[model samples]
Target: MHFQEESIDCVDFVLRKDEVLTVILGGGKGTRLLPLTEKRSKPAVSFGGKYRLIDIPISNSLNSGFEKIFVLTQFNSYSLNRHVHRTYASNAVHQKSFIEIIAAEQTVSSVRWFEGTADAVRKVLPYIREQRPKYVLILSGDQLYNMDLADFMQNHLIDPETEISLACNAVPEDQVYGLGIVKTGIGDSIKEFIEKPQDLEQVESCRQTSGQFLANMGIYIFNTKTLIEVLEDQSLTDFGKEILPKAIQEKKVKAYVYDGYWEDIGTIRAFYEANLMLTDDIPKFNLYLEKTPFYTRARSLPPTKINNAIVNKALISEGTILNHCEIHRSVVGVRQFIDHGTKIYDSIIMGLNRYGSLDRQSGKIPHGIGKNCEIRNAIVDKDCAIGEGVKLLNLKNVTEFEDEFVRIREGIIVVPRHTTIPDGYEI
Candidate 1:
């Protein structure tokens, strides 16, 4: 999606004159990205090799100049919290930044975790109310995309009548149910909103006869006043399931068409596909946009090296050394070492989790060169020593696994770190 002329103006300036607080929703268990999310929340899960999933939104906020940030986390928040403090603690951006973790709590009236997205925000309403932020920017922590939320907020400000502004992208007919299907008027004012529809008839009806269905991008800019009212109303618990539809029905919500690479990494396949997309010759999501560049905690390491390795369309992070190995269509995390004669294809290796169940891909073998080793279409976690002579090529049944030695999720095998499957073993 190309940026429309109107959006260009939205992105060119910081629209909100008042102080804005960015509320990052980081509460999902990410069960769909299992094995990987087995040890960490979706936000703490490493991505693009070196960066964690939370970095995507934090970076977006820093680059967009939205320094005041609050991340709401419920399940598995330890690692997520540590990552934030370590990465966003001492940068020039940090001087003006306030990124913290807000977990689920229990009060006298209620004793449970965040019930829903709206509830998550509502529970923290007092905290935000104390800060008196003029606008509250609510964002998801697991989606893979770079949006200039400043642009989104600007549009909402310009459209004075709007109480809620949602950033959305048009999706295919079959994929509409995974997100909120919205119906809007000509000038992009939202008329109606429906949470995930169950059937084709509902999908077609929400498509607005324009043949393009607007799927929520999980990015929202709310007028703090309206947001507080909606959140306190107890009846409104989820943004997609209640808040949004209610707002649209009241005729005050607007839709901002987001024309950029936005992918909901809600499943293993979607996460894998999004990572592979980054390895393209000229990726659809341009990471090199200077004006509004994607910012992450920089590693002051040397460059990567592929000696005698036949590398093809892959992203290898800094301090990585691949020797006589073939890597194709994969994302290798930082400071990783792929020994000679090893071949990795169509996988994602998050090198940070290099021990215990923390890692995903298990090592090929310890030592025994009787058979040949071939790992194709799999995610090999860090510190896995794939010994010589073990074949992992499951061509006929790509999703089949012989033993628990290698775990499979949505057709991707996860080899946990430091796992030693002795060589000559055939699967």
Candidate 2:
């Protein structure tokens, strides 16, 4: 227990930051994103060339001024643990503020692993209860969005009847089937949480005149007592699938309509598209917001070195060396080495630990992309070694693939960490 009772007491005294105890779920085995989640948790996976997925919610909480937080992690949580511990230490002014990691542990009372989102919280309710939280702000680790939670909390405070407040997004009609659609009745209270309502008529009924249906963002704010009551039923494992729908039936749940950019980068294809979206002329989810900046571990390395590189509409991270490569609409992460004559477009090159030329010469192990390669519509993970003249075009236009070092999911080839496509290999 890194959080002391004294520190919790300090927050309790303060009128701000104590009302809500933000609980961010560090996702389950991200099977959709296979090899990437092979060694690290989903939250620990790299995003936007610099920040990790967990950074999004943590930054949102800190930005919202919620100091007392806990991240529930399962499955290969080492990297996520290290990141939260180092990046989110106590603030200078508020020495009591902290971000703690609570990995699912087996105890005598319960030996079962986290069955789902609700179950994860149910197992750790004891610790959360100790903090004496008025409300519990449930967040997803892999969601890319920005919202001032103060607004959500304030809405709950003002509306005393609403026991649960759901952050709902106005999504396009096309995506209404993919999300948990909400139908709010009179008094702005959500009447039902429709799980993937298939019929067009059902979707039309949920629309809000903006030609977009009100979709549940999977962001939940629960009154501490109500959440505990709901979780007391051991059968309820997931929120969207079980708890929220049940709550809508029995309790007063309100829809906090949010009109903003939100992307769930859980699957490989979604992750690929979201990263490339960052390279757009004007990304829908802008990271350069001066007022509220996303927080991450500060790796203060050297500046990116571009030597005779033809770059356009790209996001190049720090400490990368692009030598005579033609890159367009791509994201290059930290400490990468792109050799001369490589043409990369609409791709994500998650950078390496160090230069790879020496290792390749010694026949030990290759690291970065070698000379004269052409890659397009792909995601190359960290420490990947692309040999000289290698072509990762997915020439066959594969929608799904699994090979020795490459994986194609939904037409996007993903090379996980430490993967080495040998010299002259063509895909």
Candidate 3:
């Protein structure tokens, strides 16, 4: 089914913004990302050289007029909480439009943390129930895509019989076991949902006549009452693993098929590849759309300055100073300092916050990339200290590596936050 630009009138005819509550789940430890999530939560991890992963979903909600949003966070959430509070301001004019964080907390009855995505929402339902929202939209935090949620919600509002609406996409059949697979029956209804189905028949059930398999996008809009009933069952932890499959059998589930540029940054390699795509001549997912712009924490920084640098296909963010460097197909974040004779290719350097002192005598912190370094197919995280002449080529062609300062996954080197690579070091 085609998803045209939905009308505001149609959205208003169905439900008001206040009647629907948007919940963003961003508490994952992001183990696959490793050092990137070493100090921050998954959602707080920087993306596209400027914004955080959480910004994608939040921006989609606000741009689509779903303003009453709540982000559920845990596992090193200090950075995420700070970013949310600083960047997203509450709408005093409307009063109902607010972006708030609900971190996993300890209660008298239970001191345990949130077990899974569904469990995270289940524990927070009591507070959400007070809002009296008709529907609850649940979203994954670390996904990169642009979605007009109005279109997704309108499908459910127009079809009152659908108690649960999910955003699904057609994926390759080989990936059926890696994602939540949906089987659509009559009228686009989800007849069955197989979460990471291992059985051969169950995988075959997800295949469509068009030679594609239906993969769940982990985006769900649920009837408030039905959600409450489902969450009341304490055994159901993950939405994809437990709740969704059972919901298809008991409740009316509908699929809003989305055919767009959506990337789940599940691994370091995926994150690196997605970011590098922005440097291409024609990016699959353009971030410069004025109609639905992405939101992020704005920094009071100056424009990037390049002095005689041979740069090509790069996204250079503000407050970076590169001098006589050769960069190709890379993303340079804010406040980065790259000296002369350095070559960067297919890499992501998460810029620093402040300029570091080269001299140790003044007791100033040391950071940023030093001179004459060679970095390729790597992810240089924020505040990393890359010494001069250091080479990060993944020389051994290793898929995974574990070290004190650097880690490699799928041949992508990840320099953790605040790591100081000694001069002349090689990886």
Candidate 4:
């Protein structure tokens, strides 16, 4: 079936007639997105209320007309695994199109898990090479943005002689130190490359080469032969350290400058800020566009209902019922029930399951927050039951609060799943 192309900027590029395989690097222990990432892997972390981090990349791949994707994970892959299975179930129409979540356990050679970004791919080297695709697309599963990768790949394949193509973007000097910075040489060929500089001087020197420094987008396209040769070399393991630099030295590396809405959701603040971007009046990243549509496990639920209440800049997922609640710049996940007389601002309320009445209710679920409650600047995980009159206040004056059930991380309150907090408790 043909997908919509509204969101993506159409590029003029012709792709080769060959089967393509995509490998998504998703195993990194997202210590940065802490608390929220404390339970699942980075890619599994919920974003924009209903979608996970993996959905961004996976959706992009499918929308771009490439299939047979593999998600490589090491740390906390349970949620990631379940999501791919349930969301992207096997399809007979696109028999060749499939999204597989392959963990470190599925590595061909050793039983030990993936070590680094390059090591992760190295472990799965054999499996991917066996696919025999003309080109390989490498992507990171923890970023936020939308791009037409087909355009990038088309540029890469322009010269059939070229081996490695890297999608690059300009990042701030302070942030470019940890990533691979390239100095474009002759004909878009990279001349210099650095992997995570140790000092400010090195960063400055690297920045001087290009007026606008180019940082790797954590996305790559490699010729099947080039990948086989690089992976076969026992001396070379990591991409940033061994393969990429060597390819640059050999004058085989090419760079594609990408000026789009791409962000690395590396920390809790960054993650929250990125989510907040979706609520922008004119968001940097628009999911409503017909083209470049972001695909997700479609929840066959009814549309949302706003009852006489004013909601400004909020993302309400399908199957959610909001009644007389004022929500501003927040995200409400699937099947959630926002009762009347509740005000939520700058927060995220995940999936709320309505089971049988516990200490008894009139058939309504006590799983989520109750009426007359006010939540501000917080993230409530799935299946949490917040009683009436509860206030999760993140005011400037209040630095920290001691609550047994609630977890406060860096001043951000996190209410875990199935947690029951008494009414009138101020967190």
Candidate 5:
């Protein structure tokens, strides 16, 4: 089917916020993003230095005037719950809007945890039914993208017969192996769906005339009745692997082509690359967007303090204190303290959670990077204490190695959160 570009007049189509409920899937184990997900849930993992992974989708929903959101989390959800509560709790009082965290719980009928994406929503059907929303918007928590969900919802409403509208992007053939590919017959009508096509012929068949495959962005808008109907079959576990393919055959599923910067931060390499990409002069994902601002917890802290630091192409978040350090092409997160003579390049330093009192009296290593350290092409997770003269360069270029204090994945060193590397340590 030939697709044409047309202007969408959003002024005529007003979306009632109360009629749509946003459900963010945050229960995935995030095994691919391990070590980072060892302590926190996938959504709670830090992203772009300042914001958590969940903040991207939640902020997008809020900016699009969809305020009633439910974040479903299961594996290691304490931090995720706390963040959502603290950051979005005030919305309930001031704006009459709320972003609630729905952790998995054992019920009379189900004693197990969330098995997959569809299963997670299926278990929450009772709570979803109570909301009485005309449409339900499902989003992934671990992706980095800014979308006007109101626009997406408007497109879904354009076709009354579109029971489920999937937001898709045209990706190259090489990128189709990890994403769900769709085949369209007519304008925006999805005829066939395949999850992670591995066979060469299967992947080639799904490619469009433009020589690009329609890759699912894991963003879906479903009629409330249709969602409930699809989840009625308990056999279906995952959305991409099971639910979407069956729904395309039996239900009216459409495609909403999105031409924007979207990156699925599923692996450590992807996460590292995505963070570093933000340091570019013209990044694909713009965190500095004015209208659709990225929202997170409001920490009333002092501004970032740089004292004679030579920094270039770096994203230094709020409340960071840099002293005579040379940083280039890196992302320094919130409340970071880099001592004098330290040099960081092509790295991501996830800063400390708080300031002050780091075992000074006990002679223990304090939080933040110590003096004279050289870190390159690495990821320093939150609240790590690297003693003076420590080098995390991974000079040998080992692909995979792990120890008590550090881990090297895909040739990038990862110093896990709350870890302490003693003085004169080298890799």
Candidate 6:
């Protein structure tokens, strides 16, 4: 199925923006993405140099004209809450558009934290009911994609029989191992649904004649009544594992096939590869679109300064200073300071939150990458102070190792936030 640019008349046929409530599920303990999630929530983690992971879904919802949005966060949500408040607080005063953050809280009835995705939404049903929405759009916070959700809403409204609509992408069979696979019988109607099926025969049953399997994108649009009815069962916690499979059996669940670029940054390796993919000549996920632009906090930082730096295929964010350094296939975030004679390749340098003191004291390591250092295939988190002549090259190619200063996962070294490495140290 092809998704063309929606005409004005087509958009007018869909439900009003106020009648559609959008919910972005801020993820739980992001165990796969270890040190990155150590301090901040998964959605608040930095991505593409400047933007947070939560920005993707919120921007897509706003650009698509669905303004009444709520973000449900659980673990380590302080940074995520702050970012949402500072960036989107202005929208609440508008007539019909607002973005609100709903962190997990305990009430008289329930004291336990959110157990899973469905549970999170179930607990926030009171706020959702206040909007009087006819449909609810569910989104994942840590995904990378630009979708026209207005178009998606229009499609869902076209078929009144569709009580639940799932956005699906066609992926190879090999990629369906950890993903929810759906089998469509006729005319986009899902016949069977399985979450991470381990048996090969079960997976093969979902493969299409085009040699691809339909994998769930974790994007769901549900009729307000259907959502409430499914959540009535307290036993069902997760949507993929518990709720969806049962819904397919009882309700009219349909699949909206999407051929666009989408990546779930669930693991550290996936996050690393996704960040480096932006440095490609023509990345699948385009960040330069004008109509559907990615949104983030508006900062008043100055332009990046490059002093004789031989940079190639890199995304250098604002207010960074590079002095005679050699960088290739890397993403340097805001307010970074890289001294001379440093070489960075295939790495992500998450810049500092604020500029550190420049006064060079004896044995005092300053923030950012120091001089004469070598870093390759690693992720340097925010506010890290790497001493001069330190090396993070993972020379031994260790698959997994962890220490106080750094961690090596999948052969990529990660310097956690605010770590200060001594001078002349080597990994």
Q: Between 1 and 3, whose lDDT is larger?
A: 3
Off by over 4 Å in 5: 1-14, 90-96, 358-362
Measured by lDDT, the strongest candidate is: 6
Clashes of 2: 0
**Better candidate by TM-score, 1 or 2:** 2
* Cα lDDT computed for each candidate against the true fold: 0.74, 0.86, 0.87, 0.76, 0.88, 0.90
Candidate 4 per-residue C-alpha lDDT over 152-223 given as tens digits, one digit per residue, 9 for 90 to 100:
777887777788999888887777766788777667877787877676566565564445578888899988
**Every candidate's CA RMSD:** 5.0, 3.6, 3.2, 3.4, 4.3, 2.9
lDDT of 3 by residue, 249-313 (tens): 89999999999988888888789899999998889878888888898888899888999999999
Off by over 4 Å in 1: 1-17, 90-96, 107-110, 208-210, 300-302, 352-372, 398-402
Better of 2 and 6 by TM-score: 6
Clashing pairs in 1: 360-415, 360-416, 361-381, 361-415, 361-416, 362-415, 362-416, 371-389, 372-390, 373-390
Candidate number with the higher lDDT (4 or 6):
6
- What is the C-alpha lDDT profile of model 6 across 1-427, one tens digit per residue? 0112253344463455647999999998999999999999899999999999999999988778777889999899999999998887754346566788998999988998999999999999999999989999999999998898877877787889999999999988778889999999777899999899896688788888999999999999999999999999999999999999999989999999889999999999999999999999999999988778888898999999999999999999999999999999999999999999999999999998998786567557889888999999999999999989999988899999998899998888999999999889998
Off by over 4 Å in 4: 1-17, 106-108, 208-211, 233-237, 353-365, 396-403
Task: State residue 249's C-alpha deviation in candidate 4, in Å.
Answer: 2.3
* Candidate 4: clashing pairs of residues: 4-291, 5-290, 5-291, 5-292, 6-290, 6-291, 7-291, 367-385
In model 2, state the lDDT of residue 203: 62
What is the per-residue lDDT of model 1 for residues 1-427, given as tens digits with 9 covering 90 to 100? 1112233444343334236889999957788877677667888877788778898888787667677788999888888888887776645533544677777888876787888899899988888887788889889998878777777777887878888888999888878867888877867888777789887687676675667788988799888898977776886678888888777766488889987888888887787788878898888776667666555567777788778888888888887777777888988887676666777788786553322231325533332111235677777665565556666656555663436567766677777555566655545
TM-score of 1: 0.87
Error of 6 at 33 (Å): 0.2
- Clashes (N, CA, C under 3 Å) per candidate: 10, 0, 0, 8, 0, 0
Model 2: clashing residue pairs? none
Model 6 poorest 10 in a row by lDDT: 1-10
Taking all chains together, each candidate's TM-score versus the true structure is 0.87, 0.93, 0.95, 0.89, 0.95, 0.96
Candidate 3, residue 140: CA error in Å? 0.8
